[model samples]
Target: MTIDTQSQRAEHSPLRRIFGSVFAILQTRLELIGIELAEEKDRLLGVLFLGLDAMMLATMALIALTALVAIAFWDTYRWQSLAGITVVYAIAALVCALKARNGLVNSPIVFEATLAEFEKDREIFRKP
Candidate 1:
């Protein structure tokens, strides 16, 4: 009787290779996701810290500057100067709001690369 070990081994090789490649692709995708998550976390933390610092410092400066201006021009331009500052602040706030809105509208959704990869996979698997 002939032992048919070579054909038996050959029959399984392609299946084993396919599984191995799938696992490798999955691992690479997961690693990409992890890297993106870390970057987003860092960006969020930095924004929070910077925003908090800006708010606190700005509050103190605005109060002190307003008092100084009103006191310095107690009789002549107190109201005018205060009104001007208010207008400037309002304009700044509006500009910031618009910029934030635009930023959100333009930003890419999360896992964009992974989604693209999955779509490519789907197309590949669908081909005859």
Candidate 2:
């Protein structure tokens, strides 16, 4: 009579099966999260560079146009036009700076949604 030891050894314990399944799920989720992060980073970087380039080019164009305008009116109102532009831009800068300062000072808390979810989880866990 032959012993059936091979079949017993081939069968996985329940704990091992559960642990393996959990590990596989965690690994897959982590891989998916990593892929999503990479995609988001790539997209943000592309947008940032494109926006910066466009803004820089626009600023240069504006400066050139301002110079052209001043040149066109050089004989009559060159200094006056420059002075008017300077005052307008200075006021705009001051307003923008004040708004930025206020925004930085009064910004809401970061990760608000995550904090809310964490509180909910804590409440659920605390209930038993």
Model 1 C-alpha lDDT per residue in residues 1-128, reported as the tens digit of each score: 13578887789999999899889888988898898889888988998899889989988998898888879888998889899888987898899789989988998788788878878877987999
lDDT of each: 0.86, 0.73
TM-score for candidate 1, residues paired by index: 0.71
Best by TM-score: 1
Candidate 2 residue lDDT tens string, 39-92: 667976997899689769967977997898799889999999988877877897
RMSD of 1: 3.3
Cα-based lDDT at residue 30, candidate 1: 89
The residue-level lDDT of candidate 1 at 111 comes to: 77
